[model samples]
Target chain A: MVLIGINEFIYVASILFLIGLLGVLLRRNTIVIFMSIELMLNAINLALVAFSRFNNSMDGSIFVFFIMTVAAAEVALGLAIIVMLYRQRQTILVNELKQLNG
Target chain B: MIDILFSIFASLVLLSALAVVLNRNAVNSAMFMIVSLVATAGLFILLEAYFLAILQILVYAGAVMVLFLFIIMLLDVDKGENFNFKTRKLSLCATILGVLLLLALILNSFSSNNLPSVELFLIEDSSFIDPGAFDNKAKAFGQLLFTKYMLPFQVIGFLLLVAMIGVIVISKKPKF
Candidate 1:
């Protein structure tokens, strides 16, 4: 019964992470990939909070705070870049942005 | 009880994440991503980190995802054909790598001695029955952020400010 604790959360996080990884690997849309990355971050946050609760330590929660801050920052920058790319190419397809491949 | 709830949310999160990736329309992907984020936040609540779970909903699902959707809406990306990898070999390699990583993670988890164990903190003189009501987690978090992690916190704030400025500069039309 007690086994339904932190390990369960870890399993959930791992599944989310795997899904995100597959999204990043298989998706061609830049926006979708970015969303997957956000998913990955959320998965990590779940693990952090779960461990924090199980260990009775506040540090993991604190880490989640910082992670959220960084994730917000990342979203801002990432969207800005995506917007710029869309302006230049008129499409958000990851495969279409091969101008830098030279 | 907890396991059942956890499994349900986990499946929902994973499914939404897959939909986000597989959906052809960028806006639809963003919407599914929002769903996934919300489900992840629910899982966080189940983990007893109520403060974090609320923050997750507020920040990621609410603020960040909205920002993403706004950008997608503003961009008006054409419904182009989905991009497929040029070489099947590359995708095959990626799949193999993914499977190997998954296998390793499961094996490592089983082999580790750090299996999950709950530690009960001794709460003296606190008669609060609702853990959510007595939750000083956010307060304690703020204190630590301001004291020990203050510099890093300020750095991140400054970085966000810079990013905002950069976006403005980039998006502005030339006056000339």
Candidate 2:
């Protein structure tokens, strides 16, 4: 049961992370990609808290808090950028935004 | 019992995640993302990190994702049919890499000999364990955040403030 505990949590976290990665890679819409990124962050948070619990320490939870803070800020800035891009191009398709390619 | 619950929550998280990715509309994707976040929060609770679980729901599912929905509604984007899952060569490569990574993680996890037992972490003190036991999680988390992790906590606050200012500066319409 001891080994199973760690294996279980790690398995869940890895699967979540993989799903998020697939979403990021395959999704065409910019907003969906952003959502996938959020999924990735949550997966890492799950892993962190799981490790912290396994070790009986509070440090991992603290790190999760900080990660959450950063994620919040990231969403704010990222969405603002998306809004601006929408205003300029009138489309949120990832492949169409090529103005910065020059 | 825990395994059953874990399986339920894991499937919910994964299925909602897939919906978020495969949904055609941006709004639907955001909604599915919120569901995935909430299910992930449930997993956090099962991990015994009650404080992180609450924060997960409040921050991710509540505030941040709400903002995503607000923006989606504000933009009033057409229900465009742009969602595509067509696999290219790169996707196949990514899939192969993902499978290899999963195999490596599982094998490596098995090789590790010092994995701690769940019983070791289970709350044994019935006196300290009650319906309100998790209520202390936030207080304990706060104490640590303010003491040992004070510098990093403050730094995160500052970072958030800076990001807020940057968003305003970037998004504000020019008057002149």
Candidate 3:
């Protein structure tokens, strides 16, 4: 008598992903956008775990472990880049960073 | 009982996530992000991924967020700017696109019936890889990592090493 359905989890994940997408699109700060990307990754992880549990497999959990590792590495690198940029430009606003557009 | 817990955690995740996005202050956003992450960890517990739940808290909520806070404080961008883009057109387009995607998801979800219904008790009682076999969940994961997942584990280690060197190089002041 499971009160919850797989589709419900899927829906929650999708909505969370959408919220992250909206955050990425709407936010002006670089750090906030970075957080939005993390949120997106979290949403995908939720979906993966849900499917893994429903399907009775440990593969999805393994993939999640890998994703978390990659995400940690990505955060370290991305923050370093942000720090470097701030050292030079003294600001982290996304709109002000248009030197590469030309 | 589980349904209530799931709903509570789900709503907590959603609200905190929204707060993370909507908060004007970076520090506030970071704090809210932590809340959102911990709530997601709660969802992981509901999913019976005790190992992942701990990792989610330790990695995402603990380590990664502390880094974010350190950077935020280091840079001192305490005052947040306007939430929306300066250009009205761009903001409108983004909002419209997000709305459309949400609509599509909802429509498809209602229209589809292919997802199989599963019994929670059966999943909990039997199908999950014999929890007692390895005597410990962490041990089970370790065995899998050392055996079936050996290559990827090594690759991840290498990737972490590369990332470490790359960070040092990127952050170091040039010595010209």
Candidate 3: tens digits of C-alpha lDDT, residues B98-126: 88998888788777554766765354343
DockQ of each: 0.56, 0.55, 0.62
Top DockQ model: 3
User: For candidate 3, what is the DockQ?
Assistant: 0.62
Candidate 3 lDDT over residue span A1-102, tens digit each: 568877878888888898898889888899989999999999999998888777766678888899999999999999999999999998888888899999
Docking class of 3: medium
Off by over 4 Å in 1: B83-86, B109-116, B119-136
Model 3 residue A51 CA deviation in Å: 0.7
Worst window of 10 by summed lDDT in candidate 2 chain B: B127-136
Look at candidate 3 and tell me the lDDT of residue B17: 89
lDDT of 3 at B155: 100
Q: What TM value does model 2 have?
A: 0.87
| Model 3 alpha-carbon drift over 4 Å, by segment | B78-86, B121-136
What tens-digit string does per-residue lDDT give for candidate 2 at A5-84? 76577777888888889888877677778888998888888888787777666677788889999999999999999899
Candidate models: Cα lDDT each: 0.76, 0.79, 0.85
